[model samples]
Target: MASLHAFANPARFLKIARPLTGWLFWTGAALIAFGCWAGLTQTPPDYLQGDSVRILYIHVPTAWLGMGGWSGIALSSIAYLVWRHPLANVAARAIAVPGAMFAALCLMTGSIWGRPTWGTWWQWDGRLTSMLLLFFVYLGYIGLARADREQGGDGRIPALFGVAGSVLLPIIRYSVVWWNTLHQGESIGLASSTIDGSMLWPLGFTLAGFSLFFAAVVLMRMRDMLARARNEARLRRMARA
Candidate 1:
């Protein structure tokens, strides 16, 4: 709690992140490049889905992080509300846009994979519908955060939405099991993965790569927002003089 509170100071946060961001960015890049190569070139085609299953290497990881990022936002929002930490609010806001991007990517990739396997672009299955809802929730968070700078900056609006969204997350996750649907139930991490070892390592690496990328982007965005806040403060002081 103390450590989190300390980072709430924008200046203090930047001092640490400035040096750390470079390493995180480059390392994430390398991991992503290596993972993409391994996923696309090294992994053999799936026995059942063939080449299309390759999409899982990226799509699955993105979906995982989409949910993970929302969790981050929710946690940060809690901190922001309780601690009134400006940096926490910035961090939460920074995540919303990128999280939405990941959600959209997941949906598109899933659709492409489905077209090859499910014989249609989309189905109103438990997983598919829940995923769609998740994407819209991300968009809602991003849009609400950006809707009015004055109101949004107050931290009330986004904070409420963030809290509400967090509550909805479990519903999304369990929707597949709760409803009888076309979407398969927990086959991999969610349940016992029938995926072969040949494909699993590369898929695992891709998941790590996507997580690293998300961390890097979130840090970069937070850093930029802190700088903007600092510059605005400086200008305001100058104007008062």
Candidate 2:
């Protein structure tokens, strides 16, 4: 807890973040490029789905990160509300845009994949509906955060909303099982995965790449926000003088 609080100092955080950001961004980009190549060229076409199965390379990672992003927001919000850590709110605010983008990507890619396999563009299934709701929640958080900043309001309302919105995460995860949705059940599991090792390696690489990409984006946004706050403080001090 003490160590976590130490990062609340923007100066201290920037020192570490500055050097790490470039490394993460380039490495993630390289990995994602390699993963995409391997997924598209190296892997054998699925016996059942054929070439379309390659879409999983993109779709699965985005879906996982989309959910993971909101989870991050919820956890950060908890820290902000409970311990009053300054960085927690910044982290939540930074995560919203990329998280929302990934969720939107998931929906788009899912729709594309669905047309060939499911023979339809969409279904009002539990999984799809819940995922859509999650995207909206991300938008809501972004808007509320913006409004709070504009009004110079305390962060508690959005923090509470962040916590409350977490209820949808579990539902999104379990929707395929809880209801007979058009969506399929879990392919990957804690105990075992249905995916063969042949395809799994590239999938793992892409997931890691995307996750690193997300981290890089969040750090960059945090740095920008910190700089803006510092500049605003300076302006206020000058005005008082």
Candidate 3:
């Protein structure tokens, strides 16, 4: 709690974020480039799925980040509501755009992948429907956050919505297991994974790259928000003087 409070100061946070952002962004970009090359060129095609398997490289990482982004929002929202941390709301706002983008990407990629595998472009399966709902939740949070800023309302409304929307995460996660869906069950897991090492290596690289990229983007957004806040404060002081 004390450590978190220390970071609540935008200046202190910026000191750490500024240096880390370039490092993270470049590292992530390099890894993503390598992963894409490896996945598309070096790795052998799946015997059954053939070239279509290459899409997995892009699809899986986006799907994971889509969920991860919302989780970040929910956690930050909790911090804002419970501790009244100003940075928490800023972090939540920063996460929203990337989160929503990845969610939409996941849906589009999934649809493209589906056309090759499922013989159709769409399915109302449990996993797909729940993920779609998650996208909607992201949209709702973004809208609410914007409204709160414009109206000068405390961010509690969006924070509460963030917390509530978390219920969809679990449903999205377990949908494959709970229902007989076109989407396959977990191919990767902590205890063991069904994916071949050849394929998994590129996938691992992509996941790492995407995760770092997400962090870099969120930090950049936070810095911009903090800068705007500082400018607003300075303008208010000038008005008073």
Which candidate comes out best when scored by lDDT? Answer: 3
Q: Which 10-residue window of candidate 2 scores lowest in summed lDDT?
A: 1-10
lDDT per residue (tens digit) for residues 25-87 in model 1: 778778878888898999899888989888888888888888888898999888878878777
Off by over 4 Å in 3: none
Task: Estimate the lDDT of model 2.
Answer: 0.92
TM-score of 3: 0.98
What's the lDDT of the predicted structure labeled candidate 3?
0.93
Ranking according to lDDT, highest score first: 3, 2, 1
Q: Model 2 reaches what TM-score against the true structure?
A: 0.98
Off by over 4 Å in 1: 190-192
TM-score of each: 0.93, 0.98, 0.98
Clashes of each: 0, 0, 0
Q: What's the lDDT of the predicted structure labeled candidate 1? A: 0.82
Candidate 2 lDDT by residue in tens digits, 1-241: 6787687777789999999999899888988999999999998888888889898989999999999999999999999999887788998999999999999999999999999999998999999999999999999999999999899977878898999999999999999988999999999998788878787778877998998899999999999998998899999999999
